[model samples]
Target chain A: MHNQIFEKYTKADKSSLIPLLQEVQAIYGYLPEDALTDVSEYVKLPLSRVYGVATFYNQFRMSPLGENVIRVCRGTACHVKNSSNLLFALEDALNIKAGETTRDKKFTIELVNCIGACSIAPVITVNDDYFGRITTKDIPSIVKKYAGKTKTNGVTVTEEAV
Target chain B: MVELTINKIKVKAEDNMTILDAAKSVGITVPTLCHLKDLVPSGACRICSVEVEGFRNLVPSCAYPVSEGLVVETNSPRVRRARKTIVELLVEDHPQDCLVCVRNKNCELQDLAERYSLREHRFHGESKEHSIDISSASMERDPGKCILCGRCVRVCNEVQKIGAIDFTNRGFKSIVTTPYDKGLNVSDCILCVQCIVVCPTAALRERSSMKEVSSALESRTKFAVAQIAPAVRATLGEEYHLPLGTDVTGKLVTGLKRLGFKKVFDTNFAADLTIWEEANELIHRLVNNEPVPMFTSCCPGWVKFLEHNYPDLIQHLSSCKSPHEMEGAVLKTYYAKKLGISPKDVFVVSIMPCTVKKFEASRPELTEEKLQDVDAVLTTRELVRFFNVAGIDFADLNDSEFDNPLGESTGAAAIFGTSGGVMEAALRTAYFTLTGENLETMELNAVRGTDGVKETIIKIGDKELHVAVVNGIGNVREILDQVREGRSHYQFVEVMACPGGCINGGGQPIHQKTDKVLQRMRALYEIDKKMLKRRSHENESIKTLYKEFFIEPGSHVSHEILHTHYHSRKK
Candidate 1:
């Protein structure tokens, strides 16, 4: 918990809560639980209120970011194509719940609403690459590809797989 | 005053008043679920939606300001339809098991449902499955039953200033929960249970010890003993539909006896003992120039609050356990020895006005030789349930006397039920301890009433003592900030977590009636006035206890049995 970000605002200035939290999240990638306590003291707001505000907004995240972000669309079009099964399979394979980063920060899984690609229907995206009409069997191979990537490795494959 | 016509009746109300207040002034009942008096109205429930003459949509009477010439129909056909639909929607997501709920007939939501004549289950929505949180020793939370009225959240944040729980997530997924959605025991919750008092549904309640107590009473090996707190006497009558502030001490004793308790003792006896020890402790501190502004440790909620928020100031809180805990300790030790029974075999059940006492009883520090002083705690409301379960006629019961020795108490102990009671009671004894003379005026009017914070200056001989009494925990911050900055001038301070003290505690009868706390305060003072001994030092039983076992006030033995230490609960 560095005091550098906190130096931007006066102590107990409640109006600075959202901006302070955004700054903290930007520096840490996600709002760390320990840092939230420090943020509470800095803003003179209760920790529960701080945590409440953090959880209310979709912009802020509580857990650390993984090297690769996996988004599973649970939109109406994807629902009819059994996209939930793919989500479950990914959760089992990665051993992490949706909206949680893996312990090693290798992969983070999130359940998103509409990604506006109904033609791709049951879609699961890894980084910027999209997998269309994927099934449960495809989850293991998708996870394997991401798990092999190093921290500095960049995704060059932009082709959408079906 | 702003003139408004409510339900075709002309009413004059203050310009700043809301539509709800204007209607209320004309005796027109406009029902509200989310509107809490004295707090900022959120208008979340919209149960008080009223038809205004010019408004396109029905405005919430609770939040809508009253203006001149405003025509408001509190129960118009459209307003009724909207209110019914809101109730239907609320009940659709709520559980249908009202028969087994803790609130049952006493529930405000149930009353609203009946008032709206909601006979049909109009709407069916997918209910959110929430696991009941019973991790805390004091209270339980069932989010499944919550209507999101924000009453509990408002009271927790606004009144107590302890935001242990808040609305988390967004839209339909929102819930009032602790930080990280963790158990309250692990969170910064002080187990005050103020949230329980404000909750309209069975969403929040005191954790029951009735079963534990019943089983203990049935056990032949266990000698069940009951101790009733000062506040319980003044407030418990409300459950039996008796007059408000009726001191049912005698009836309470008789009822406890009928429930199979071997002896019924008064927590007031220990309250006197607390004063004896606390006054001496204050004098010691004042003379030696020790920590000034020594806080009263009687309210477990306040003690836990200080421990969590101001761990560095724990030294300033008196080490004395609360009155009931003190009585329980004495019962398990001196009384048990007198009866030739082991402390573990003597099961002490405390009947208190506080929900926090349930948590306080479970503290390891309040135990000796691995045996907790109080086995279980039953709140005033729980005691009502106990009586109902036993089929005991509470109002008709013959008035009986409290068992001797531990049952005896002075008038100083009786006033411990209200705010400033402890300070007044302690000052009475402390004045005597310092100057060997009782206060000329027994009533400390400065400390009395429903004010959040009270301050008084007393001149005792050559010594002028300054003191402050804080009722609501939220109001203590200003004084505490001063103390932290070394600007506090008071020699003594008292803080109770609940506003207006134990008389309006979370465990007392839940009602929206005004002046109930004031009536209870008056009744406690009346009890003090009628007592034979007005000072704690004048109690003969306390004197006997001191002579027989504890030796004297602030003795090593007294310190060991009666006093307890606090640790920081910061996370």
Candidate 2:
């Protein structure tokens, strides 16, 4: 099923693994287990070694991402300004924990070290659009915006618990 | 060779050799943890820190290479303090219930603490929390006792190549666990329990069935019967401070009898029966061109591995039940019927030198009408504990013989403890059955040894058979790859999950050296040398068993009672 994804790197040696995984992840947004298995077979390395290497680097994600990706900044500036609480609030609003996608694949929450925007403390980026100085109270509406629902327009809000 | 100075002694070592290896060459005892002799060095544990002349910080002796003219101090004051602090911290984070731990006095951390003359825990009152994972039938995982040494992880990944467990999460919460922290049962674990053997602490342990066995023996309604595997006899003596290769078959029988077991049988008898059935099946396969390589199904770990990973190749597995399970089935059926008792009243317990036997006994297919064939499996280590708990002096116990009927076995059965033994035994029987005569010399020396994989072509009469023996579980990959790629067509193949087979089984006494396994192999060969009947077909008792109970080798009745099937597993 994933032959086309790994067709180019089928005969590649050990050194081509990371680039191949990157290419596959770029297409799928995350490293699926089946693709990793195919990569392991293609590179002739044990699945554990492939997985161990993939985990050592912070760039690789093991699970597929949801349609809407949310990156919550846990930088030193954000933490001091109660961004951790904002993260929890987003987790509740999206009904998904950090590093986990929602059951309906509508939203995903991730906690990253820094986004290089300390001036906008407690920032949460919904996709490419950044929401700066995000408060716990702002999590629901921000999640609803990507959930394709508007409370003022009388569109039903998504509150599915994982 | 690189010239280096270890503790003021000039030593010449390899260029890429680690400081620990260099020190050992010159008789310097540099302590090491998480440093397995083979495979890759994961120098995660910092207990092997050594002081160097130029380096500002103490270097982990296990990971650091011995450079030219490198001066290393293995036991300097700073190194001692650092090592002590590292061990103290490991102990502080670990549970303090050493008095009742399964590893107890045998743990590596406990040994270090004692060697350092640790009077009291210098650092105290740490959060001792862990979820004890006993989900696996063969083993247990105690996260509290784990010091994050990564020995088990390396063994599982590198040596066995199973990769059932790995270092999950990061930093403080880092643990050696199955993917997504799932129980080992649901994972791709073959239940080999090789990780348990490499573990320095009590983090990985056998899922002991001793309590259930004790309770079964105490039951007034049931008559408890015990069977000891061939490998258990070869290594059980080591637990009592006896020599590694000392064969305690007789003494083990006496100890079992003393412990109140009504009937004491040998799994060797069942091993003979397995050969009898498996050899005929091989002959059938060879003649009919069924599965090219009829793989032995004795090792449950290997069987599970094939079922989970190479699910398509399950056809190569022999239909014959493992030795102990076969014996357990006969004990509940033939033995019980002959004694005029219900199968339920005959409680079967197997003393195995394998942790996978515990899982094998629990396999639903091995049961008969909701009644398990083997009620309990006590590993060789658990048997030693049982012996101690019963106050039986195993070292001085008088030798005793096994009971009648199901107790008799041949030399071929005795050698089933070591690698390539099943092949040798089956070859002896198959050659005899096909040619109607035994080979001039009963021993087939070509397939015998500690090699990872041994391949040979033996001529019976007009037909030549391609045979191979694989010791380690990881070593089977090449041969299986050959099979998958249509490269080689082996008529018969033997596989053992443990490196040296059941003698060095995961459930055997803990010993680091591989040479000890060789000693046990020699012991098994000695048993073969002494026995008058060296082939499975020569056992009169087995012949009688077939004549009275099953009627024929591949009879439908025999298949019903002694045969089983395998299914592909979800990882």
Candidate 3:
């Protein structure tokens, strides 16, 4: 599985570590520790450096992926409209805090800085579908939508989604 | 040349130099929190900020390169307020328990707090809470005191090339830690504690054995004995405000004896014993043509590094125990039996100049009948503390002598603390053992500096031995690669995990403002030159020791006590 990732970057080297990490994250949803170790050895960088660069940017995740990646926007508009309350309701309903995946691998919650969509204040995104203008009452049903639904490649797939 | 005015003083410096270096050249000292010499300047800590005439904001002096005509004010009211605010903030997040802290009066952060006249925290609240990491046998990690200066992180990656720790997590929650915050023993850490050497705060420090030493001394049933390493004599005087490399060998012996040690011995005797045994082993390998390039295994850090990084090359390491390990075994078995005591009754303590010696002393492989060879290991810095706590006036004490039977050693044994000292000492004995003759001139000057790598060739008899001496563990990678590629022809190699040898070991005093490692190296050579006998084989005590105890240097009985085997760690 790691060799396939290495084969794409014959022209790219250590300078392309960020893009390579993005590509790996696209394939694996999150960076695996074993894969990062292999990348560290493959790129001739220390494991600490690999982890350092990976952690520097917010796009990469070290934790395992859940079926539904819930991004609750904490942007100025979202926070002003009480997105934190919505986040708390989501955490309470799913029993998993932000930056955590549920034990069933059904839902993962994330609190992000911004999503650049203030037209609909308090946006909560699950996979590619956006549930803007969200409320605390909207969390249970939204979490139940991802429940018991079989995902493509362990994720709800969309043509335009990452 | 770059000319600039720093605090109304005209200074001329190089064009590419940072403002910090430029100010340093003129002796106008600027306080730096994160600037470690020889590391890539991490301007993360903005404590060294200075005001420029045209700039609206203060610039970090450590990362800012000086222009030809830049006007800078380093000590204006605005600059002082900014620096004081930074110090206050750092102090606010730090635990104010300096009175009970390990680095109490000697901490860099404490010094800055005094220099800035910081009375109390202005915005003090919510200090980061962290549990102390005492998982490493040789060192400890207290993240609460860490200011995120990145000195320990850089040193672990850059100088040592062992990336066991780095900045993890993000933002205010960021910490310098191992992978998954695992214990350092489980990480690729060799327990060398080089990271502790560069740490400005008590965030990283040696896993102290003072409590263990104190308990052993207070025990009435056990007999407490001590052995001091060669490097300890050269560097211990620095803690007493003596000039670096002041040879206080007599003072060390006097202090240990005064502090209730029943017997005081020298580790150099075992160093000589190591030479006698290691030389024989080298000859055995040469004659049989097995393990062509024999690696010296005197340094425990380097030995563990080899076992972790290159397990296949474990065969190259000589099986002889390190100098202190050999001394500890002999103290428990030979010396204990001679004194009509059980090995269990003999509490052997070693004062070492290396942190890894603490971990090395606890190795199960070095034990006999489940009894630890050395009971406790103390660093040179710890000995200095022990002296102060015991009220022993170390400097004023009269010169003392080492105990008999295992106290005698030659000049070759004294030089074992320096980088190339081991190779030179081993060659001297191996030459004598093979050809039944010593070299006319004993000083191998070619291999005796603080360089990262030193290569030389010396004719022992008919064979011209190609030898390489590696000062740091990072330098061993290339040489090991060369040997593995079958492209190198060196017969013997000496690897010291620290930049200099044991004189600059991680267990020494911190932040002495001089290149004392060089001075210590010269002091060891001076001690060797003044001695009547210069070779390890000429140590009469070792000769009598072999005849009385083991009958031969490499006999079955000697191998059981004095030698060790290596195994692969899951790296």
Residue range B405-504, candidate 3, lDDT tens digits:
7789999999999999999999999999888988878899888998899999878767898999999887889999988899888999999999888988
Query: How much does candidate 3 score in TM-score?
Result: 0.95
Q: Rank the candidates by TM-score, best first.
A: 3, 1, 2
- Cα lDDT tens digits for candidate 1, B373-419: 89999999989988998999999998999997999999999999899
List clashing residue pairs in candidate 2: none
Q: Pick the candidate with the highest lDDT.
A: 1
> What interface root-mean-square deviation (Å) does model 3 yield?
1.5
**Candidate 2 Cα errors over 4 Å, as ranges:** A11-71, A79-109, A120-126, A131-162, B1-3, B12-17, B65-68, B119-130
Each candidate: how many clashes? 0, 0, 0
Fnat score for model 1:
0.91
Which ranges of candidate 3 are over 4 A from the true structure?
A11-13, A150-162
Model 3: lDDT to the true structure: 0.88
With candidate 1 superimposed using the best TM-score fit, by how many Å does residue A19's alpha carbon deviate from the native? 2.1
Q: How do all models score by TM-score?
A: 0.95, 0.90, 0.95
Clashes of 3: 0
Residue B395 of model 3 has an lDDT of 79
